[model samples]
Target chain A: GAGVSQSPSNKVTEKGKDVELRCDPISGHTALYWYRQSLGQGLEFLIYFQGNSAPDKSGLPSDRFSAERTGGSVSTLTIQRTQQEDSAVYLCASSSDYLSTDTQYFGPGTRLTVL
Target chain B: AQTVTQSQPEMSVQEAETVTLSCTYDTSENNYYLFWYKQPPSRQMILVIRQEAYKQQNATENRFSVNFQKAAKSFSLKISDSQLGDTAMYFCASSSGTYKYIFGTGTRLKVLA
Candidate 1:
């Protein structure tokens, strides 16, 4: 794809329900990132994937938040037992490689509304 | 740990005017990168400009430029000849030697007609 792609642009789920968001990064990109944005707040780092290394999950707020990238192309963010506070936009980004100066391209975020 | 901060919550500028957005970050790493991203109603994050901490000269892209102060931990975005299309939420971010990014609370810029 020419740009990063995300699915389920908008989702309204009941509290305690689980939701899965998908992201497809640009071809040949070796680094991927996930972020969460609450209403009127800045983007919060969630996780990072660099090549075949173990993902950097230091930013995950809780055990309910988890993500996986398959074949180094597509990624999934799963929120278990979603809470009302989980209502936010989930963003995904990809970079050519995991370098300090690498520029990241972002996808249209998925807006999750936990009702 | 790294943290970015945007002091201004909202700003307005007339078409053809110039506006500056403020940002500051804290990090102990010496090798790092700074970035400014724009997000319109479409929700796509677009890179506006970037600065390398090691470079003393600022980075500029046409009408967009940045004033990066490494010692003060400040990075600001200046938009010259602002246009109505420039109305959007602007974010400041930083990345250390690692690939993870830390973003600041955005500034909502409204370019008035």
Candidate 2:
């Protein structure tokens, strides 16, 4: 089975620029998650989508961060006007369902560097 | 809100020896899930083991086991006969019925051969 996959393994951009990171969850996975991992820091939750239900946006660091999961298969995290502080590894994950008991399969992640 | 904590920042263990990584969490939910995830330098996160909070019996997957203390809000992962391949950053996480998960700071483990 194919694992979760992310696009542009590495991205370098100037401050105040916008970036879009894509994620392709495993086939049939109805749950998708986005997280940010800063240098030497733990994975920080960003957002989550479960089927057609409303996405959880509580973890988004700021108003500049937003995500959209279209067709219940793929997800995109958009960081508008990115700042140097936004430079980090963006990870995507998916599971069988939204159940807490299910294990989330992670992607290799996109390392976004904002200069 | 839930929080997970890993006290040890780094730990080194001799190959084939046993090592345990400590994790504690704060949560109000009674029935949930605890997980140990390993992220190597490759940046792929792998599930090491998992424990159901309601289950009294500890969860074990071959050489990897977990000490789940629901009352104390603690969960620790023990690795026996460690291998160099086991060297990675280990993160402890807890989640309730919600899809969101809270992760610990992570412990960097080094297996010396």
Candidate 3:
């Protein structure tokens, strides 16, 4: 089976610009997750969507960060007015369900560089 | 709030030897799941092993095993007969019914030949 996939493997933008990263979860996956990993730092939870339930946006660092999952299959993370601090590797993951025991399959990640 | 901690920043073990990575987490949920993930230089995160909070028996996957101390809120991963390919960053995580996971900072392991 194909693993999670992220588009635009690398993106470079200037400060104040907006960028959208895309993620395609495995077929039939009902849960999706987004995380940010800064240089030498741990993964920072961004957001998640589960089936038809409301998405969890509590992990969004600021209002400038937002995400949307369409048809429960694909997800897009958008950063408005990006800052230099926004530069990092953005990773997406998905699982069969939201159960605690389900393994989350990760994507190769999109590295965003904000100058 | 749930929090995972990995005190060791880095560690090294000779090939064919044994190594153990320590992880501790604090969570209020009584039923949850703990996991160990390995991220290689390629930046791919792979699941190594998992342990359920309600299970008393530890989880093991071949050479990879876990010492899960529920009462102490500790979950440590042990790798025996370490191989060069085992070198990577290891992250410990915990998740409950909320479906939100808390991850540790990670421990970088280097397998020496």
Best candidate, DockQ-wise? 1
Q: Model 1 residue A32 lDDT?
A: 96
TM-score of each: 0.97, 0.97, 0.96
Quote the positional error of residue A93 for candidate 2 in Å.
0.6
Candidate 3 Cα outliers beyond 4 Å, as residue runs: none
Docking tier of model 1: it is high
Q: Which stretches of candidate 2 lie over 4 Å from their true place?
A: none
Go through the candidates in order and give the clash count of each: 0, 0, 0
lDDT over C-alpha atoms for residue A59 of model 1: 88
Lowest summed lDDT window (length 10), candidate 3 chain B: B94-103
lDDT of 1 by residue, A77-113 (tens): 9999999999999999999999868999999999999
Docking class of 3: medium
lDDT of 3 by residue, B1-113 (tens): 79999999999999999999999999998899999999998887889999989999999999999999998999999999999999999999998877777899999999999
lDDT of 1 by residue, B1-113 (tens): 79999999999999999999999999999989999999999999999999999999999999999999889999999999999999999999999978878899999999999
- Write one digit per residue (lDDT tens) for candidate 2, span B1-113: 79999999999999999999999999988789999999999999999999988889999999999988888999999999999999999999999977788999999999998
Q: Candidate 2 vs candidate 3: which has greater TM-score? A: 2
